[model samples]
Target chain A: MRVSKFDRPYESGRPERHQLRVENISLSFGGVRALTDVSLTCEPGEILAIIGPNGAGKTSMLNCICGLYHPQKGRIMYGNHNLARTSSHHLPKMGIARTFQNIELFRHMTVLNNLMLGRHVHMKKNILTALLYWGWAEREEIENRRFVEHVIDLLEIQHIRKQMVGSLAYGLQKRVELGRALAMNPGLILLDEPMAGMNVEEKEDMARFILDINEEWGITTILIEHDMGVVMDISDRVAVLEFGRLIGIGTPDEVRENPDVIRAYLGQDHGGRS
Target chain B: MMATTQCGVFHESYRSDMQLRPTTWQRLRVVVVFAFIIILPFVASAQNLRIANTVVIAAIGAIGLNILVGYTGQISLGQGAFLAVGAYSTGLLMHYYELPWPIALVLGALITAMFGAVFGIPSLRLKGLYLAVATLAAQQIVGWFVRNWDPIDGTKADGAARELSMPRALFFGDKLNDSEFAFYVVGMIALVIVAVVATNLFRTHIGRAFVAIRDQDIAAEVMGVNVFQYKLVAFATSSFFVGLAGGLTAVHSTNISFERFTIDVSIEYLAMIIIGGLGSISGSIYGAAFVKLLPEILRDVGLWIADQGWLASGQLDQYLPFAEDAAFGLAIILTLIFEPEGIVKLWSDLKAYFRLWPFSY
Candidate 1:
């Protein structure tokens, strides 16, 4: 199948020195503060992990970055754009994509169709061409399918490509969610608990994919996980948050030894075990 | 022992995988079915041909409803209203403005689509039963307006509604006879074109977006699908086909009463999609045929019973009409209870069962 011209990656030429700088981003729901005064920076092609106990505002911060939840104060600067103003629907077109903490896949759709939707922003066929679907529409469809097949290959999900997402096992469903995000060919990908309820083997495979996505694909990544072993093994940098407050941000080793991070985890009886 | 058992057809590419009929056997089956349909008019009587025309028209409307409710997960009870709009608009344009029927048909579809989009706006804030009730209001509003509006003297003195009669269908200045006009122009040819267009639609990004929204709307949003815009497009496109079906119906029957586009017609269209299979183009056609033929079958059975002299003819005839309605309702209930995936799934299961014949596994 021929890949459509639109399915090609966005050529910004050489990858620019992209950086996502979140400065003092504060978020709240009425009286309940979810994230307060959280600041972090992710450099180009680096895998940054955000780690915290439950309700430590890790997902909230990712939501703020993805434009799903606008902060009450501060700014999220991705290169030149202010992400706080960007609508979640427009984020994908602007080269930002994310997965959900709970797998948010189109459950009734086949895995192929779900991943093909990741290329929605790149598809340019209008209704007229779609109805006439033999010429331009078919070409574009084949092209998009080629890109989706690449994602399926990368995620090693070729066996269940035609299976419905709802019928798949939980581990495979998480991988499909990752494939769906990668199908967007995003410059900056946010992964919210991508390896949440997986076995040790599944967690290792997910970590390897994340590392490959960041290094080989030259895509920046923000991963949120409760598994400290996976986080420390793959992440280039780590940021710690405690009850809506940023407690530490540094290289994985530095953040691991930080006293405030230890107090926060130990105080809540979260042993930060593997 | 046959160690080298044949698997099904291999789809080497997404292109092949997406093909409507990928296997040789599937292609052969389709060809045989189409050949049967093409030769049906030659063998069947005029009355049976008329029933076939009704089936095709109903299929178009059913496909439209399936797109909204089945693929897009937006329940709409306003198909009857949209059909009325299409029929009335086409009728008025052809009669008063002396427009060509083809142009009038397109304009009628466009008008009904606009109406459908307006009704779909409420869907942004409502869903499920709430949205269903909101669309039901469209039927009432359109029905009331058509009955009372006197600009075209819509209401007759005897309390019967005015009929919208279509002009003789002109194709390159030649008048087509009733069967040619109805079956060729408005039935088979129209169905083929609509079916092809619909199949092509499901293969594209827009169609995938509709399915995504149906499955998980919040997920669809994060993936860059404009949920509100796509919802409106779904409504508009569904109404477009239903409106075209409405125009074709007027042309086929030569005259249409406002009473024809009632709530009962809306329910029948919904039942067609549900009983046939939701979110499937071929399923829509099967559903239409089943629903449309049920009444005819009941009538034939009634006549046979009366001829046997087992019962009084007048008494049997009186109850036979009610039996048709009861049978229709029972079919819907039974289908939902036994096979919620509908007849298409059931048929596929049977095919699979036979394919693995002589091997219980």
Candidate 2:
């Protein structure tokens, strides 16, 4: 039988296509291999979902893409630039932004400040200017604040703009985290379990926001999610991982019908759905 | 959550413009504080002035410690050692090279910052208790070398006898060997350092990164902050301020000794930050004043009680010696248990309560 559109076979991008590419990536923590020879590529403006069992190294792959982890073996290429060798600090500048599996909002700061921190990569003011709050610093601050406000509106978190992130509800906090990542205005965005513990309503809201972010923002999105329903609904393509190896790669319908992918989910009642 | 409700209307008003202090009352408070500081020298007694100067200098050190320990969450027992570097460098430069006091002070701070950067190398690899131990070891090694090395002190040895001398002050052609002069000098320097640190800390990326790292290192790293570089910067910045305080203390006093900058001094700084409220610039000043003056007050009270004929002089001496130490220990324990947020927090809370009174439910 022909593979479903959801499980469409991997097609190499055109020669001039600017996209993020991972080649033969492998990462081992101590003796445990978190990822082994895992390769995936995400094109601009495409929502690629990496769905896997609990220990299938979904988050690990995201980490490698953002330069959080230097794979023992692999090359992460972003828009023709080799990122594996670049400093992690330079990732945001290189148009890559990420949110954590566990919401990583700056708890003590206001939601607005947390988002503004994302703009730190692009801020051009020096220490002297920042200290004096003069000249270019004031202009820079105003510009960044406007950009952060735009992100807050985009994430639909204007009500919680001045609220401390720690004080916000879980769903709002997640949204604020998304706002923070969006403030970076990256060409590629990574979302790790964005809807991890949310109820159905919250999950729906998050899924809509994620879809809007990818579509309206015109940004490439790589999502690691356990909610197969949300993944199937929003993802243009899906990559299924089982024990550090990609079991299947295609569109959602194709992935849903893959025998290996079904067996990986059925082998153990992972029960990750909320 | 319960305590949050008790916050007063003034706090609520201030909280509305938390980042922007646009209120007239808030601006008035700043003016009042500056006025009090300006008038303090004239109104305080000689002994009080001396004590206030010590508090100011100690506050500078505590501010540095707050940046490292309180904000960055790096426990450093070696801050006193950095202070020693500054103090000794300033003392040596002023005494032997006849450098001006201002030049000596600047040079002292620069050298100390450099030394702090050097010592910060080990922190790139270690954290928590292990990092604390490393800094403690640094303290011991730096302290020992400074104490033993005569050349560093600008002193020549004469058959095992160590003759230490006080640095001379040359400001406005009038020598500043008196307590009042030292008090003014230290106070001005302390004020300048506090203002610079308070304003610069939160406004800069490095400062924000330090706080982020303190909360969660892995999360911060993932956000593209150079965790190692920021951490090292915190150590270096904290140490520079600490060293400047040490140099000021050395010049402020008539005599110099190794015992003054011992591990005990470092612990004292830690205590100040703890009691003052961790992660607060103003708290450092409050903590420093309380720690420095509390003993002096106790000593005076003990002396007064001894003169009352209710207690024998010999008995008083035996009991009084331990009394101050015991009182200080109890204060720390009680503060930790009851007011973990420290005196500055309590003060702010009270002020907030007053501001929001009647409507504060």
Candidate 3:
């Protein structure tokens, strides 16, 4: 659960391994600015954490990356794709999967069904084949179920496989949401407040799962978490936003010691958690 | 209650696990229902057989509506309009082109499916009651077109009626003997096929996506489900079944009119799904039976009351229709109040109560 900078072969080659780049992005709603000239890069197979106080456009930045919002100006380059032109429906298919801040598991569906839905892009059966539910459809289903089952196992949600997601506790629902994103088998995973509203035990479990997803699966992750302790321990890079501006971006240790970052946290009396 | 929940029920393989009816009791129940339906024509009178026919037709329409309004969670008040599209297309193909019944049926379904998809385009941007109102406009537009078009020659002078009859619903190169026989054979077969497809649909990837969209469109979109495409598919799939049912109705009744596919008819469909159980395939049949038969039962009650000298025949006639409509309205209200989940839940509850009798736990 500790952030080991040298355990991985990424630090020296970080710039060369850049997988996502957000440059000169400005977004607004009506007359209020949400994000302005915000820029950051996520290297391959590393956890990049975004920390900000409330109303600092942290969620809006994630929304911009996943094509939920049109930023009015700037470019979001993910590999060769421009995220500004990508729609939400196309995000997962293009290897970008995200979990919402609030749990968004399909409430009436079983956890298995919700996870299976995460494999929507992977399953290629047409309507005719789906109607038969045999041969090609059955084959595709079993193949995808193997992946979903792996996610279920990884997230330790086997006990609630058949249970409706709506009836679950909030922490379990959040885990199911992460399992859903994992089931997508994406190259880049965007998790918004993955450990929000969890007890210490649940938060520790989530932190471990996030690390496992990033290290073991080689999946690039952009995480937004309020627990500075967990963020400092897990993240390879940290970006700080305040009042719609990127005030600092660096390694967690470097960002933590910056005077501007210190002043920003103290200005809000945010307990130096940032 | 724990007896059934115990871990004795076993599936030996993946194929068995995916079975629609995994338990012997469920299989037996399905067999018994089909057997009873197959044997009903011999024991029942022709009039009663026609009622069965109507239920079968309505059940197909109800199942279609359920796919849109139930599984997909899209509110549609335009199901009847889609039915009209099927009926008219099939009627025209039969009347002018002289196509076979099967071709006409398939083509009619496809045409109505296209119309349904077109009407569904607005659904991505609109939802809930607003979407319902937009679909209501579809109903109005279709109704107006059918009433005023007069494309074929069988229009009555009043313009309200059209002699939209099937020459004879030919089954395996043999003509159906009568309307009762048609319902017994053609309608029953259609119901079985549609029920099977509709039941299997919810088990597949596409069906799950539809349910996901219904539960939460934003989450479905984020999960790689093309919400817009799936919603359109749901509308088209629903209208296909309704249109096919409409084709069956056109052939069985040998007459068609704009009044048949009115807003009231669409609301009746909504009631059927709600009263039957929103997301259950078999519930659609229960709902269709309840809705289609209630008016007949009420009319009989009204007639018996008049015969008992409680009222003059003229006065009874004046109020009888109102009584039937009022009874329908009351049935929906009562169903919503007592069992919002519908008759399927009620049936299950009753079964559970009986199974756990004497203990009261």
TM-score of chain A of each: 0.92, 0.89, 0.90
Ten-residue region with minimum lDDT total, candidate 2 chain B: B6-15
lDDT per residue, candidate 1, B1-361, as tens digits? 1112226667678667778777788889989988987788788887887788889889988888888998999998888998998888877787789888888888988988888899999989898999999999999999988776664444357456776666777665544236553455446877888888988898899999999989888889889999989999999999999998888776665666788999988999999999999888888988999999999998888888888998785888789878988999999999999988788888877776677677847
lDDT of 3 by residue, A33-123 (tens): 9999888888888899999889889999999999889788899998778897688888886778899998878898888889999888877
Each candidate structure's TM-score, on Cα atoms with residue i matched to residue i, is 0.93, 0.90, 0.92
**Candidate 1, DockQ score (0 to 1):** 0.51
Model 3, range B1-361, lDDT digits (tens) per residue? 1212213576555456566677777789889998998789889888888888889999999999999999999999998899899888987888778898779988998898899999999998999999999999999898777767667455577555555555666776555436476556888888898888887777778999999999988888888889999999999999899999888777765567767888889999999999999998889999999999998787788788988999886987799788878888888898999998899888878766776676756
- Compared with the true structure, model 2 gives a TM-score of 0.90
User: Cα deviation of A140 in candidate 1 (Å)?
Assistant: 1.0
TM-score between predicted and true chain B, model 3: 0.93
Stretches of candidate 1 off by over 4 Å are A1-17, A268-274, B1-8, B11-14, B158-160, B170-181
Quality of candidate 3 docking, DockQ? 0.40
Candidate-wise lDDT, in order: 0.85, 0.77, 0.84
Model 3: residues >4 Å from true position, as ranges? A1-18, A268-274, B1-6, B158-165, B172-177, B303-316, B351-361
Candidate 1 lDDT over A95-125, as tens digits, reads 7889998999998888889999999998989
Residue pairs in candidate 1 whose N, alpha carbon or C atoms collide under 3 angstroms: A3-A143, A4-A143
| Residue B150 in candidate 1, Cα distance off native in Å | 2.5
Q: Considering lDDT, where higher is better, how would the candidates rank from best to worst?
A: 1, 3, 2
- Ten consecutive residues with minimal summed lDDT in candidate 3 chain B? B1-10
If ranked by DockQ, best first, what sequence of candidates would result?
1, 3, 2
Cα RMSD of all models vs. native, in order, equals 3.8, 6.9, 4.9
